[model samples]
Target: MKKYLPLLLVVALVLTIPGLNLDQVSAESVDDLNKQIKDLEKEQLELKEKQDGLESEKSETEKKIQENLNKQGTVKGEIESIDQQLDTTRANIQAKENEIAETNKEIDSLNNKIKELKEQIEELKEEIKKLQEKIEKREELLKDRLRTIQKNGGQMRYIEVLLGSSSFADFISRTAAVNIMMDQDKAIMETLKEDRITVETKKTEVEDNKTEVEDKKVEVEDKKVALESQKQELVALQGQLNNQMAEKETLMAELEHEHEELHEIELTLAEEQEVIRAEAEAKKKAIAMAERKKTELAQLNKKEPAANSGNPNGIFTHPAKARISSHFGMRYHPIFHENRLHAGVDFATSTGTPLLAPADGVVSKVGVVGGFGNAIFISHYINGQSYTTVSAHLSSMSVSPGQEVSEGQVIGATGNTGNSTGPHLHFEVHIGGYGNPVNPLPYLK
Candidate 1:
């Protein structure tokens, strides 16, 4: 304002009338200045309202930004947990598959062993059959010998043959030949009996071995079946993990969309703040012109006095009777377990607890606004400067836009909506302009 004052003074001098008395000129100047001051005051009111709206918007956006940051942290942690579980599930499935492969190989080996045992048993059966046949043939020959001895008077047959031979050498030859024949028959019978016993013992051993291999095959098959079931369970777990990851990703997308909205609001708020500053400067210049004209009029009259206007700036009061739940600025979030800006101070309260307006103001906004849930924005002028108040995370609001509200008026109700961990009232104050928040503790008292 001071930067443009010299120029304004120079312009005033150039516009002074040349052929009139100072009193006449002063009256004209005062009337024109009065009109200008009225226009500037009207414009000032509009600018102040705009400034409050933008400040409210910026505060809300910052709250949303903080909420998204906390949400992102939570979603990312869930995703990481799902990833870890997926790794474990996959490893378990691989192990089961490996076990199944080895079991199949063992089953194959058992089948081969069983087949070999069966072949060995068949060979032993063939040996036992041949031994039985040879024993039967030898028994048939011995039966014929016994029949001949009985027909020839049993023991006397050999003696009669010796007597009928009429020669000692012929008798002795017959005796030796008979003795050799009987001894050879006895040896053949003993050999056949021993071979049959040996073949039967070998068949028993082979049969036992076959039974053992078959049992092993059955056991291994059972193990494979159990392993398959385990693999299926692991696969099911993998499916559950995939679903969790998808849900987390969807939540992250929503948070990102919210962050984008906040970015747009921030940009718009910055531009509006600049506009408000320019309008304030214009209002300042208009006030200066009004003062200049009043001075001139007073000098001409020499019998005037000016009255001081009372300041309309109001004081702030507590909006609720709750304790501070969360403070403004950076802190570790409880749910997300990560550091993030809190943006607004949270007042601990039960759900549906009514909130009050801190000062006389006009409600600028009343609706659901992202993480703030049901919210209210109020515009106020304090000490000739613009400020905005934001109340968030409400279950219900009782006010509407452009509605006049007095100090301690019920505006909304507190709640645990959006990204909150519990029921609370989120309150913020943006003084002068927008963007960074100042500590609202002094005002909340």
Candidate 2:
């Protein structure tokens, strides 16, 4: 009977030990899972902070770019105005140059005409001198012929000799000789008269030539006066043209300078845009990584029992070292000039402060949001229930979407961002795609 009692006690002890060991294993696994979830939540909070920071930086860059564009537009308008002025000035200068050329041609023609008139006048003077010499020679010849006739007794003796001739043939011959002498005297007189008349005619022609030369000289003087006037006018016009050319040159130079400045500004803008694009791409990649991690955590949570999944009382740790500057609630916006609902809490902190995760979780979204600036969202599990936490208005981010993060891990810092009055972090708790915005104070310990 004693042997049978010992065997029964041994069997009972073996069954009890196995049951207790199974219970202990279950409890240990639940605790370990909870710890991991808290760590991941904290990591997610840190990533949210980093995303907020990036968004703030992007906003500032956009503002600066807009201002630069406005300035460039104004410069372009000024350049266009200058270009028009330059064109007008150039046209005026060209017209002036043509006028000057025409004036010079007119002066040259006038000078040539004056030279021809002078030559004509000189030829007329030489003709008048020749006529005067001929007249004087003819007058001397006439005086000599009259003196010979008087010395021959006026020729009455020759006529009587011819009339008293004894022979008829001698009388006839004497008569013929007398007649020839008379005819010769007549021819000499006629020649003298003709020479006198020629002299008178030549004198008259010389007077007419003198009168014409005087008129020509007067005309030449008038032409010279006119040319001088034209030359003076041309000089004045040339001066105006020179001034216009100088003005045009100045305008062109200014336009060129403006063009260069615009080009430089465009290059700067392009570089800035490239930098912004790279930063945005990096942020997007980070968000994707965070989402992947959230999906993995969700799968893990699904496999666990509800009681062993996560914190059931909604207790979460603070994500970073930051002071709350504004509480989540309805608030007045300065720019909008209206009361609006503030979806998150604002935390004031120094630039580049380290941000930490609030609980164990996975990063879900990380990127820029318009009003929130740079922002990040983390998905966390609490007793089989999933919740998302958002952080905004940060200067930079350090984590990516789908990345696993533990509690209190560094992810980003706090900063002032879009629609912000000061440096602070905006934090919020969301469930089911922002449909429910819960109080962060209730969830965070």
Candidate 3:
């Protein structure tokens, strides 16, 4: 009973909320509202009971759906999924409808029971009242008899009546008269006692029945509230399911478009990598051709690659002002839960945070390439080693392909775009080509 307090309070609040005017309620109106509420509650309870039965039906329906999926072709599987949803929804609605009927019948039964109990209680009360009155009358009569007997010397009167006989015939008649009076008083006294017990017994029985009825009424009211809430929820869910079926084609088209878009992005990335390979080949050819005139070029230009800065391994700096939220490794993804290589370290940064260039390099590609929303790929040939740094999931980019950038320069902004969960830099360092990746954390200053 104590556990029911919260539920009751919730019901009260829900019914009274949203600008309901308490002052507008008259006694009659309150009574009417109470009657309606009780009816709704009862209806709700019945629907809920029906819902329980529907759960079993739902389970069975789901099993049927699984069977369809297991045996059907791809196209049929989709159609079956929708059909299953419709079947489940229809089953739920039917259950609630049946519940409504059952509830109404049960409510009628409860009302009839309550009426009978009230009538029985009233009859008992009337009987008790009558018995009380009878007992009172009997009590008074008995007291009067006692008083009369007392005035005439009580037990002595009986003896006197028997002894004070004029003749033998008179003695016998007086003795009979005394005996009849005593017996009549004793019978009335006994009747009074019995009536008192009868009144008390009826009163006790009525109290017990009244208490039982009150408890039952409370139980019915609570069940009604819960059922009403459940029914409304189901109604709303049914509407949503109907809408899904109506817009099935639109949803299917959207999904197809997404897949096509992904394929295009992959093709674009492949094309860009091809362009890089072609450019690298061209450079290598030019260097080979220049080798023939190496002595003459050395005499003209006595310059080698720039030396490492005063700072230790000063080839790079942090790409953004952030801590490493995720480390690069073969691990399960947070969202997909698939074990895949996390190509780069994820620097947890706010959206719009500037992504600083870790080293002087030429930007190779910058565009909406794929899942890496707005990406920037930079290529560097330092100390005869070809290295590429790929920064992905950018909110915005400041550099373009073929653009040159120095260390600490802003190339892009961090973002939660492209297959990303939140705003963070997905930075990767690749050796040789984009295919080879090593941890970026080892290079960050």
Task: For each candidate, give its TM-score against the true structure.
Answer: 0.51, 0.34, 0.42
Could you tell me the C-alpha RMSD of candidate 1 in Å?
A: 13.4
lDDT of 3 by residue, 6-81 (tens): 4463345334334445565466645543543454344335444544555565455455545444433453456568
Per-residue error (Å), model 2, residue 379: 28
- Per-residue C-alpha lDDT of model 1 across residues 334-398, encoded as one tens digit per residue: 43457967667888999988898876666666776656667777766443444667788888888
How many clashes show up per model? 0, 34, 4
Clashing residue pairs, backbone N/CA/C < 3 A, model 1? none
Q: Which 10-residue span in candidate 2 carries the lowest summed lDDT?
A: 279-288
RMSD of each: 13.4, 19.7, 32.0
Local accuracy by lDDT, each model: 0.69, 0.58, 0.66
- With candidate 3 superimposed using the best TM-score fit, by how many Å does residue 172's alpha carbon deviate from the native? 46
Worst 10 residues of 3 by lDDT: 283-292
Model 3 clash pairs?
41-224, 42-224, 44-227, 44-228
The lDDT ranking, best first, is: 1, 3, 2
lDDT, model 2, position 282: 32
Q: State candidate 3's TM-score.
A: 0.42
Cα lDDT over the full model 1: 0.69
Q: What is the lDDT of residue 429 in candidate 3?
A: 90
